[model samples]
Target chain A: MNGKYRFLLAALPLAVVIGLSGFFYDRLGKDPGELPSVLIGKPVPEFTLPGLEDGAPGLASADLRSGTVTIVNVFASWCAPCRIEHPMLTALAKVPKIRLVGIAYKDKIEATRAFLGELGNPYALIGADVTGRVAIDWGVYGVPETYLVSPGGEIVWKHVGPLDETVIRGELLPRAEKLLK
Target chain B: MKFLLRLSSPRRRPGPFAGRVPLSARDPGLRRDDARGWRALALATVLFLSAVPALAIGVDEPMADPAMEAKARDIARGLRCLVCQNQSIEDSNAPLAADLRHIVRERLAAGEDEAAIQKYLVDRYGEWVLMRPPFEPATYALWFGPAALLLTGVGVILWRRRHPATVPEAEALTAEERARLDRLLKDEDPA
Candidate 1:
């Protein structure tokens, strides 16, 4: 081969090697947990924890089946989104044929009660996950993740992140109404 | 003594060949060694070329516990280091990424749930810290862009590979150029 062509031929594989190196390097550092969820429409993880109110009953999976559609809200006293979603939660609680419960994730009992007091109680039954064990059991990535538990106690739908009035009227209500029947 | 003198004589050194040859001219075997030297150089270059990338990936600092490091890596994979758009906080060595990793460990150590820790980060940093942005109408493009790009790239590559270059149609040859080509071919050059 001519000198220039020989040099070019040799450099082609080097270029490909550089490209492959960059591609693999880019892929190797990828965060695997960011994998798009496969859990949509699947049954939610089960949890049973003590209810936040003193002398009140603890919450269990069976409680979600008490002949009412329930929203199991995963919230923490420190979560700002939960505060933003509070009014929507309160509104949803007032919606007939639907009930709302709060699961206090990784928060102290006193702080959770104080927060509820300051922001008007919206849950019919509140559960405390003081060590956050229950939140993990629910596969929660963050709050306020609301799960719509059917009257049969099946976790029919999950809303990850804060709730909004739009979600209430549009997505959650439409789905919960179907499950209610 | 005369025979010994003839053997040691330098009389041949004054000929026209004085400057033309060096000591290696005495050995025909060494004449072929130039080819061997070129082959050795090519071999050395090929070996050096293959060793570079293998050396680079192996040089990272070793973590104290590869298991917790793997977990930290897994958690970091889900977290976006706010300073960079393309890298996970786990893969980033940015000061903020390091601080976020430390906070994750601290939360884990405190018996806080993984969800609570992630939620705390989201609360502090806003949802932008999440590697996988939440599914909402606002993020529909992000969620769907990869598939769209894949299809677009495939279409482009396939089109480019299948299309052939068009040959130009015969042009009306310029009078002068046609005459010149005809003369050269006929070996006449009448012009």
Candidate 2:
């Protein structure tokens, strides 16, 4: 091999090291708990869920298509994160023209009422998902997942874990502000 | 040597204070030691390979129909458990995996074929839900990268072998050195 080419051969290990490191470095910053949803840009799954209580209005996919953006929060009384992110959900419900509904996933009706009584009710419509069948249709793996649906009923964005001030203000609000305008 | 030849003896039998025979350190020319090591290595490899299937987790309750149950198991084997990314739904004990199993069984009982049921899951969870990813433009690199790397490595090795680095030629020994070399070769001392 030529002297110049020998230098190239010698740097092979260094090159490989840089290449491998660069590949992993790109992936390292991403949160493993956050999974990319395939439901984005697709219409929300059609279904009717019974109300968490008899008097409360139940949530349905049709309600999302009333020419307004909807924020669907999947939560349960048993999930700790749901309690933590409840204030954020309450704050979101205050926003005009953006409908915020809740699905009480796999929780008893009495438990749902007690939870709402304690934490305060933020949802306009609450769905009772005792068997979590509706959750499966929505492709929810864990509780306290939030989904943003477009005015046309297409799912636009999703946050996998609990909502925080940063995520709501930076991610959820900005996208919502666009649709609302 | 006979005592040392008991290579198969349990290591714990001879405590640190007892039978302090560091056979490897004592023996330098014993090539037979590596034979035992190689045999043990082969046995370990065989045992490990045989246990691979046993490592797979068992499935949940089977359908009443034997044929339907077999079909459901086959479908479950392809779907991944969302809770534990590495385990298949059939092999995982996660609630989500169980829920997915229930869905699969229900859908199958509803007369949906395996492809349709899988498609229903894929629509919701994306290709990540499948144990085997689809052969698309995005996954072409993932599917073929290993084989490409292996071929490239073989090519580089063969190229290196074909064009070996040049070695410098040694200068011829002078007459005096040759005579001294011959004298040294002829001399012998019997111990």
Candidate 3:
């Protein structure tokens, strides 16, 4: 072998090893349940969902575009994690200039109402997703997905699973506050 | 297509434990590890199903038009079942998969072409919905990385062949080696 470039040839195996190790190490820490959404920087999908009940005002894409940062939560009475994340959402609702919206996905209206009633409704507006078509438009795979839509209707941030204090304090609040600025 | 073959990508699932607790309600010890068991079971089932054809779950009502229904199936085969991960919507028994299947049928019934139907899904779920991703800047590596690696390997092999490594010249035998060689030659059995 040529002496000059021999080190490069010798380092090739080590480079491959390091590269593969780094790749697997990154994979090891990642939660397999977290699906990377491509919609993060895009505008919220256009949707018009009926109110949880007939009389109550329904949620529209326009509502999100009403010059306010809307925190859209996809929840369902059937999903258990929604209960776990309900309190953080309530806290978020108290923050001024943020509209906390809820979409009840694939749940009966009565059940949804009863669940919200028990949890103490933190949502400014609740939309019924009886057929789950609206949830589909939102690219909601399952319940308890939260999205932070800017006043301009862009999805600023999203959390797939239930929200905890760590997520609210660390991720959602900071992102929403930035959008506010 | 090769990356698509690697099953299991995350999309965030409900704590399958929290949702189903019929056994755990009565048997306390059974609750904790049940989710893992179910996940393994589901994975096995999905692998088993994928080994066979993309079987219709029989839950979906087919479109009336045979031509349209065939088109729906063709499109559905390319669309992924989110919950089932690698399994196509046609193969998955999940409710959401059924919803997607119906949506495919409905779109076809509405006289939408295959491209339009795919665009609708892509708009909602992004390019991930397609089993075969579209060629774009972001996916250029995925589409051509293997070929690039193979070409580099071939180039290296050809270069090495042309620029063959210099092997050391054979050393001159010392007096001891020469004497030993002569003795060995003399001791050789003559036929």
Interface RMSD, all models, one decimal each? Answer: 10.8, 1.2, 1.5
Highest lDDT model number: 2
Candidate 3 stretches greater than 4 Å from native: A21-28, B1-57, B153-170, B173-191
Candidate 3: residue pairs that collide: none
lDDT of each: 0.72, 0.86, 0.84
Which 10 successive residues of model 2 chain B have the least lDDT summed? B10-19
For this target, which candidate reaches the highest DockQ against the unseen true structure? 2
Residue B11 error, candidate 3, Å: 54
Evaluation by DockQ, superior candidate among 2 and 3: 2
Residues A95-177, candidate 2: write the lDDT tens digits. Answer: 98888999989899899989999999998888899989899889898998999999999999999879999999999999998
* lDDT, candidate 3, A42-102, per-residue tens: 9888888899777889888889988999999999988999998888888888999889999
**Ranking of all predicted structures according to lDDT, beginning with the best and ending with the worst:** 2, 3, 1
Q: Sort every candidate by TM-score, greatest first.
A: 2, 3, 1
Error of 2 at A34 (Å): 2.9
For B1-191, candidate 1 gives per-residue lDDT tens digits of: 22332334434232466447653475454435545555666887888987864543232343466665566557767988755657876666554466567667666656676678788777444577788889999998998999999999999799767875456699898999999788789986456
lDDT score, candidate 3: 0.84
lDDT of 3 by residue, B67-169 (tens): 7788889999999888888898888888999999999998888889889988988887778889888989999999999999999999989998998877799
For candidate 2, give the docking quality class from DockQ.
medium
Q: By the TM-score metric, which is better: model 2 or model 3?
A: 2
